[model samples]
Target: MKTPKNQFWNAKYSTLVFSLAGFGFACNLAKMLLLPENTNALVFSLEALAMLFFLALLFVAINCQKQHEKWIKEGKEKSAKNIKTLMDENEDLKKRIAEYELKENEEKRFASYQEKMLRKIFSDGKSATDKEHFLHLLAESFAAGAAVLYKESEPSGQFIVEEVYALPEDFIPQPFVLGEGFHGQAAQDLSPIVVSSIDADMIPVASGLGNTSTGWLYCLPVVKEGRCVYLIEMVTFKEVEIDKMWNEISTRLVDMKIF
Candidate 1:
């Protein structure tokens, strides 16, 4: 048990055993030579006793060395296991940090894109024609390819599609009544509507020379002068974000002075 504790103690114990064995062997040799005139049996017995003590000390020295080596090997094994555990935990922490940074960067990028569109809408001429061009610009930026601009018709108070971009060859011009359809419902509620799956028959998009489904539709009502006066409908080939996209667009159009 003492040998299994500290290496310093084990080394000291072995050294002490070797020193005692040397001193005992020297004393027995001196007694046998200097006292040669004594009894032969007594001298022989003293020599035998010294030899046994030296042998026992040698055994203790070797045992201590073996126990120390075993303890050292066990310590190394334990240290290796602990080091491996720390390395695994460090790698997991690094992965989590990287994932968080990626998500934050994505949110910032989307916000920047939305802000750029807001500035583009306000940098054009104040005339009604300029507003239609702004709508066309929005369609191009969002990859929608189809955009319709509606103004509240005077006296009739109907939300009609006054201007359009990328209309199909077979498309017909229609005005939306209150709560009539998706666009109408958004106008009635003064809210935004998003349709992820598009049916070309029901919701048509004019791309190039033909009518088709773009798989995504968004309609927003622009409120001005305390009434829902305008509506913008967009059809896109790809899925669009709901909150991030529509929220910014509606917020910008709410204060826009171009009626």
Candidate 2:
């Protein structure tokens, strides 16, 4: 259970001590051989035995040092693996939390939008067929820079702009058949359409100061009695999650139909 650092120091200390002891024994044996008068048979035999003992101790210390080094290597590799595993788990947890928070925020936005629409439709007793009022309200609720509501002509089967909110005075609405363009496609399919990366000249909002270009355009269809009667187009500088609220609005509008 020794730490790598402690094991390293212990191995080094043992090697040093055993090496010094072995070297000292060898020196003594050499000295005894030089002084032949003092080198008796019995004394030489004892000195040789002592030298062998030190050599054995040195060998054991060297082997123990190698074992300690192996243990340290294994410990470092295991520690590194554990650290990597923890880091991967932490990254995964962060991703999950971010996804959950994004979903929660979208739900909150949808709830607030629905609540405001309900108040305008029922609490204020505003007629659902009032295209101008609803167009402005929808644009304000979704924070759009500009909005336009298109109504389908009953006889001609073409969609034409009926109401506009925050558009330039010089701006004109283009009329199109059900399958002609993005606005028409949403009405034809009875579904929402999203257009992105629009240029500044495409949908421009004029103010007293200047004109600002919108980047995103959303086309939402209004269904009544199994048919699309209106297509609302709104533009904003940035994208918003307005698509999810379509289902709720469609349901309420269908329920409140005059036919």
Candidate 3:
């Protein structure tokens, strides 16, 4: 019970053996017909053996040629697969590099905007007492719907709204203590507070057109001599670069004696 592979090899070997034996027999018959009087068996055997050796060498050469061709074809296919893998890797690397460059450019533009904002707001030669002008500047800079400037009242020791910008005339600002609401909390912590995606139920911001729920709110406290001197609240209908604005303000606020 030979397997298919064993059967194939057996068939091939049988064919080669039969072909060699048939050639030897044919040669002997031809020699007998050509030289009837000189019947030398040794000469016939030598000629037959030489012919079989030549045929075996030819078969060996042909088999080696086929094996060489098979090796070449396999090597070419493997090389092609390797080349395709390398090309795919190169494309992936290109995408990653492109993403990194885009992110770097965005960061650069954000930094530039922050730098300009710092120069415009802190170096305007306007005193902190000019609360209205300051609020107007901030509202315009951030595209804010409304803005409120609160200053620490020397008499009451409470944060009181000093100025308002772009808000309705009827809207009144309520004063608060150090730990009261968002503005007071920012002042208490000496940090900035950001609120995003406000609900309609919360306090609505009133503009010249009408009252609407603000999308974003920012509360920033200006500190001087280890105490919060002012708190600024900005409301916008769209998101702004609040972190960049805060960074610029905090870095430069310490230098200005705005108290």
Candidate 4:
């Protein structure tokens, strides 16, 4: 396809060639009328000039046509490149969307698993409950091995350790008085406590005799009817998605016991 610019130049060159030819013809006729005795020079000179003009114009027209073809070819190539770039970008966007949806689905599935575990723990109200079995279920859910449950008592305000799932053999189960350590503080304030990393020499993993957890510890207080009723603790080796664990799992600890 020829561009508008190429077509305009073609027309302009053709017009100039025709105008030159007409002017030469008019000059030849004038010369013939003025000197009929020596008309040979006028005829020969005008014919030669007109022939040269036509040859030059023909060469220019051919060159212009070639240039026009080149312009059309270049335009097509540029369009093809742009189309390829756009297709690549679209594929990248689609891959990103697919990854996001997959992540969302996995999160929902894990949250569902956490909820089901809670429901199972409280399945039979009065049935004989096994604290160890319940803790094992919790550990499996979190991909961790250790678990603990605490019960907060009245007036004296002590948090007694009710269950220990996978503590080390040397570790002892004990109680925590209010304001003693982070665990005690969590009980007193009725809030959740998360230690991303534990330093054994500095903080006590167990309250009574003081044991180092040696890993991450999560302490959550379960409040009921304006009083803190329970404190659930767990120390795990792997890093967890803290916000998701807190939001989806910890909140369900209310009214739940190790039994």
Candidate models: Cα lDDT each: 0.71, 0.73, 0.74, 0.67
| Per-residue accuracy of model 1 over 79-161 as CA lDDT, tens digit each | 88999999999999999999999989998987887677666655666533577777777777677767788888855567767
Candidate 3 regions off by >4 Å? Answer: 1-74, 151-160, 174-193, 196-212, 223-229
Q: Which candidate is the best by lDDT?
A: 3
Q: Could you tell me the lDDT of residue 206 within candidate 3? A: 39
- Residue pairs clashing in model 3 are none
Instruction: Write down the RMSD of all candidates, one decimal each.
Output: 8.5, 5.9, 9.5, 8.4
Model 3, 204-234: lDDT tens per residue? 7432123447578788888777778888888
The residue-level lDDT of candidate 4 at 135 comes to 58
Q: State the displacement of the C-alpha of residue 34, model 4, in Å, after optimal TM-score superposition.
A: 25
Give residue 13's error in model 4 in angstroms: 20
RMSD of 2: 5.9
Which candidate gets the maximum TM-score versus the true structure? 2
lDDT of 4 by residue, 1-259 (tens): 5556866786697679767866866785665567666558867677668667866876786678678768877987999899899999999999999999999999798777656655654464532356556556666666665777777766567878787776778887678777777677777876767777766566566543246566677776666666566666777676654434553344444434332
Better of 1 and 2 by lDDT: 2
Backbone steric clashes in candidate 4, count: 1
lDDT value, candidate 1, whole model: 0.71
Clashing pairs in 1: none
What root-mean-square deviation over C-alphas does model 4 reach? 8.4
